[model samples]
Target: MNARKVLLAEFLGTLLLLAIVVGSGIMGERLANGNAAIALLANAAATAGGLYVLIVLFGPISGAHFNPAVTLAMKLRGEALPASLAAMVCVQVAGAVLGVLLAHAMFDIALWQPGDHVRTGVAQWLSEGVATFGLLLTIVLGIRFRERAVPALVASYIFAAYWFTASTSFANPAVTLARSLTQTFAGIRPIDAPAFIAAQLVGAALAVLAARALLPAHSSVRR
Candidate 1:
């Protein structure tokens, strides 16, 4: 029952997260009159706001991990049970895909179209690494010092990261994969997902190690 609860929470949280991302991107693009900056602003703001609400709603049930990278970090940090990590990632990915489909359906777009958006190069990969690193770092520190503020902290960081990062900070592997299925403003070329996922893994691992070394030994937070 407990595992079921975790899975349900994760699935729902991830679904909502991706829906916000893709839906807002489409809406923003349609409304922005070809202004990339304005479209991005709407997308980022909606994502951040929706993410915060979802986390608050689901944190008690599944720790509100809508990202596979975040789940991996928790697993490595010994916060998440090894037996549960695989299930969590699976559900998150599935939920993400479903979310994209939902968004497309709402916007009357074709489902499962591959994205053509070309997000690549060394700089973009490096930005993904940095973005994931910061995200995990914030989670770890927030859990340890200010558990109550984690939702807001994470949302705010992501909102800023969208503007600062070259690739707009798709810090979650599941999100990167799902977004590849869409041809919207939030989409990334399918070919680019692998590198982004790789960067996110590296970043998550680094954040786990850093947190282990820096945080107090007896901290209450698991990850």
Candidate 2:
């Protein structure tokens, strides 16, 4: 694909993913009001459905590395070309910012309250780690194995991660940054979000390194 096309793909893919996360969470919250279970289910459905659509939609154009962490990981293992890394990362992040800015226009949200910090601390951190790992693992296995399971793996991994991880697994960096802008049900406190994003980047990088080590050298080289 052309450079401009790839950049557009990343931009659009990220917006789509962010929209699902923010839009569904907001709608679910308003609908459920006091029902936590309903909210969680709605969030999970949005995550899974969002991923399924994104993977297919952008796979051809940019391989849909909607997260900066994922883009870095792919670049590490050479699965992604290095030439477009900077462009992709910048566009992806910008897309995320745009997505959340738009979300702000759509939602009724408030500025931070003191108690909000407490909710975002432990739960968000742990959830971020698990979500990052799941995302990395899905990419590693699906791409490495040449499995026809890429779509299914991504969807299922994200869905299961929501319940297993406390933070509901906000794995995408673009999503994280975009969310920080909302101050809504899906928002992440800006201060705390960076640390979680760092953890995610570390996890993704490690997974890429481990995946690289697993390949047979000769086979890897023959490509």
Candidate 3:
């Protein structure tokens, strides 16, 4: 039953995240008057806001792991049960797909339009790695030092990464895959997902190692 609750939270939270990302991008594009920068700014702002709410709302239930990279990191850190990891990833991916479909429906677009957005390249891949690394690092340390600040810090990081990173910080594997199914401003080409996912996994692995060194599990001391 506990595992079930965790999975449910992961599913619902991931779904909401995708909806916010894709929906905001669509809305921003339509309202930006051909200014791509303006649209991206709007998209990033909404995503960050939605992300903060989702994390705060779901943190108690499942640690609010809306990203596969985060789930993997938690599992490695022993924060999530090993047996539950597979189920968590499965539900997150499923929820992400559903969120894309829902967003498309809401915007009156095709349900599964494969994106043609070219988002692959060395710089973008490297950006994804750095972005994911920062995210996992934040999660590990935030939970250790100031848990309440996590939502704000994470949202702020992602909002900033949208502009700082070449890939706009699609740091989550489930998110990357789902975004490939939409041709909206937030989408990535299906062909480019492998590189992005690979980069994210590598980044997350590195983060787990770094967090272990920087904020070891035994380092927490109550004040």
Q: Model 3 off-target regions past 4 Å? A: 221-223
Rank the candidate models, highest TM-score first: 1, 3, 2
Best by lDDT: 1
Error of 3 at 22 (Å): 0.2
Q: Give model 2's clash tally.
A: 0
For candidate 2, lDDT tens digit of each residue in 62-94?
887888888888777767463377888899899
Candidate 2 wrongly placed segments (more than 4 Å)? 107-123, 218-223
- TM-score to true structure, per model: 0.96, 0.87, 0.96
Alpha carbon lDDT of each predicted model = 0.93, 0.75, 0.92
- Lowest lDDT 10-mer window, candidate 3? 214-223
Candidate 3 C-alpha lDDT tens digits along 59-131: 8888888888998888777773533778889999999999999999999989979988999889999999999
- Across residues 115-136, which tens digit of lDDT does each residue of candidate 1 receive? 9999999999999999999999
RMSD over all Cα atoms, model 3: 1.5
Query: lDDT rank, highest first?
Result: 1, 3, 2
Stretches off by above 4 angstroms in model 1 are: 220-223
Instruction: Decide which is better by lDDT, 1 or 2.
Output: 1
Q: Candidate 1, 178: how far from true, in Å? A: 0.0
